[model samples]
Each structure stands twice: as C-alpha cells, then as structure tokens.
Target: MDIRFIPQAEIDKQLYNSCVHFATNGSLYGYDWYLNATAKEWDLLVEGDNYVSAMPLPRTTNWIGRTQLTQPVLVPDLAVYSVKPLSPKRIQAFWDAVPEEYRGGGLTVEPASVPKNAGRFEVTTAVGDALFLNKSYEEITDDFPSTYYEQLARAERADLLPVPALKPEAYADFWLSVHGKSVDNEWKYHAMQRLMYQVLHRSWGNAAGIQTRDGQLLAVSFNVYSHNRIFPLFRAESKAGGDAGAMTLLNDTLLRSHANRSLKIASEALYQRSR
Candidate 1:
C-alpha cells in the first residue's frame, strides 16, 4: 500500500460520504463533528487496490488525525476515537489496522484523550431540577459555591440570562480576562480564532452572545450541533464583574430553553473537570 497525502478538499466526496455513512451507521461518536471541522484539512492515503484518508482536527496548537482506511481496520487509540453502537469486532478490527508508529505517541484516538469530554458535568437549575444533562466547566473545584447555581437559576427565571454565542472581535478581550491573570498564552486566541471560523461557517449551531444588564458584550459561546447533541465550544465572560458567573448563567438558561430538544452537552476531556 502506498501512502499518499492530499488535502481534505481534494478527497473524493464518495469516500467522505462513505466515512460519514460508516460513522453514523457504525456508531462513531464525534466523527461527524471531527469530519466537518477538518474536512478541508484531510490527506488521503491510498494503497495499490484500496485507499484511506487522514484528517487533522486542530485545537490551539494541538491536532489529532482521524484515519479512515478503505477496509474496516483496527482503530487507533487516539484520544478522540469514539465508536458507539458499533460491534466490538468491527471496533477491534479498526484499532488493529492503526500504524504501529502511531500507537503510543502523544497522539490519541480514544475519546477520553481528546480533552473534550473533560470538565463535563450534569448541572441542575436552582430549583434542583435537571436542567442540562451534561455541562463542562473551565475548572474543577471540590467546593464551588452552591450559591452560584442559585444565582444562575435566578438570573434565568428573571430573563436576565446570558445566551451562548461567539463574537470573534471580542476574542482578545475575553481571553485576557479568563487566562491572562495567571498565564499569558496565545493558544486560547488561536483556538478562539478557529472556533470563530467554525461558528461563522455554521460548523457549530447558531452562535449568540451574552450581554450585561448595562448592555455590555460580556461573553460568547459556540453552540455546536450534531443531530441531537449541542456542544458549547468556547464560553467566556468579561472580568469586569467579580465572580460574574455569566457563563454559568448562560448555561442554565440554555439548558432550560433547550430541554425540550434533549440537547446533550459535549466537550473535549480537558474541559471535563468543571463539569
């Protein structure tokens, strides 16, 4: 088999369609979102009689490649590999085909390694009702003030809630407030940029914004959509208010509003601590 690298945009649509079909029918979780996010950055690896494609999905400076072999092969143990509802045999076969060189590197194929599922939690409304099924927090705390939830719930009930949205222009200001106090890194900015583009392209759900009572743009969140799942890509708030809790408030409102749709909160493992 010859390994050939090509841009994702150049890959045959039929092959992509096949991957999608396999993902959906074969119980691949996050595959749809991964494919859609990295569709334009994929490289196809072909053999004499068969072909496969590798697509890279980047978050900040880190990236993970999703390999699609022509035949069902052993899946790699990448941090993002999620094949639910798929037969154990098929999943094992997929993992078996993963290149040995790719096996134990920092690269991950398992869903847990992606850092997306981190900080995911099921947060309830102040009324102690299960408002959101799964939620991700920026930090994990053993004793987060319970009052925060109550305040958030109150905010929602009063219709003073924040909506999850992505505003690219506010990226710099938001990051400075969130991470700058501790360490100044540009990774968040890059991630935000990619997220903004994804939002602009509607790669995620409809993006929206949160405002202060004074009408200040406080934060933005990316609402990622995949059939029934809705993941918030990036959620941040201004630092002007001490313990603003705008993000928490926004999440509460979103969950309450989206309860009828059964929207599941999804994220990489890195954000799971807060959940």
Candidate 2:
C-alpha cells in the first residue's frame, strides 16, 4: 500500500517501462515514449521497488492556463497498471496518491479496474467498443451484413487501393488540412500533431490510407500496434472518397492485413463508422 510520486526526471525508465510492458493489462499509452509525445509533463506513482503497481500522471496546461493532470488526446485509459489484477482498495491507493493539484482533472480506467469502491473521488462512466481479431478475416466478417462487402466493392470499383504504409508527416498534414479548423482549439490541434509524429517516428505504429491508382489521396488512418493489440487512433477522409466508400475499403484492408492475428482493435467505432 506504499505509494509515492516520482518526478518525471527522477524515475527509473527501465524499471517502469518493464513493468508496463509485462503487466497483465499493459497498453502502448503507458509506455515512456507515448507519454513523452503526448503529455507536456508527467510523473509517476509507484507502489513498490519493482514497480508492482504504477499510474501515469499526464500533465498539461488547462484552458485557463493552470497546470492540471489531464488525459492525452486519443488515449483511453490512464489508471493504475499492475503486473497482477488489483483489488479496488489497492487501485484506490494509487488514485489517492495523485497530487492534490491534479485532483479535479480527469482520466479513464479500464472497466475491469473499477470494482464498486471509490472512497472520495467522483467517478463517471463512458462506453467504448473493441473488436476481437480471434478468427480468420472471413469468419470475422461472416457475422456482418452483405451490404458491408458491397461497400468495399464500390471502393474497389472506384479505383481506390490501400496504402499500407503512409508517411506519418503526410497523414498529419492531411488530417490538419481537413479537420484542423473544426478543432476550434489550437492547442488540441498541435498536441495531436505532436502525438502523431512521435508515435510514427519511433515506428511504434504506422499510418495507412486509401488512394486512387492515379495517386489521389482519399482516406487515411493512424493505427498503433503492440504485440497483441492495435489502436485505430485517428482518421480522416475526403468527402468524395467517403462517398465512394474509401473509409470502408481502408478498414477492410486493415482487417485483412492483420486478420487471424488474435489482436484486439481498441476502438471498433472506426470500423462501424466506415460501414
């Protein structure tokens, strides 16, 4: 139950990263490189010398210019990650150890992490979706309606082909040019750009897209992969391409590329939207 905060610089990256990578519920977002790219600043709360349990406290400047522990963009869960399953009380200890200044700020925990006890902190719930890639692509799609294949066929007829390796910089520029104005907040846009670059630069993941044979770019998506999971993080599509079912084709390629790998797609909403 002994938990203490370690400043970002003072923590042992090797030990901490080892714990996260090997933990039962480890995620790419919990890794050091991920935090460096997304969080403006961060610290850690550790439960034991071997890092038996740990939580990442990502910090950022709020709209009002005050420092707060905030969730990074596109990051879903940021709670205690432990080598073994944690009891509600042990999880609560890590939450309590978070510095008071970051109290009002929020982050998310995996559903399995919460077990009916939250001593003094307020808790809110949100729903997310994931797709399990446990079977062959055909078997996985067998449950889908025939219209889904029709959509992909339309994209193929339109001459849209999958670009399995899209340059990160190109994807970022494409995303910003398309969705930047809609963001309304400049900081969020820049933060997203930084995250995309760092993640791709480190080769932690890759960006893929659908484009015409004549080389007209249409739809693009960024996916981060670990040993057993893939996170379909950000995506943008041109109006014409979307109408031609470019997104559907892009997602189909993604599914086919990693089919039968037993990987999990963190956000299945992307696939659902394409349909």
Candidate 2: clashing residue pairs, number: 0
- Residue-level lDDT of model 1, residues 1-275, one tens digit each, is 23344354565655543443344322122243344433323233322222232223322112465333221111122221222333444333333334432323233343322332212211111111112343343222224566766656544554443544435656545655665653324645554565456556755555555666666665556665654556565556656422455556655555556654544544331122122
- Clash tally, candidates in order: 41, 0
| Candidate 2 structure quality by residue, lDDT tens digits, 52-121 | 8888888777678766667766566765789867777777777767787664666666765553655444
TM-scores of the models, in the given order?
A: 0.55, 0.86
- State each model's C-alpha RMSD to the native: 10.2, 2.8
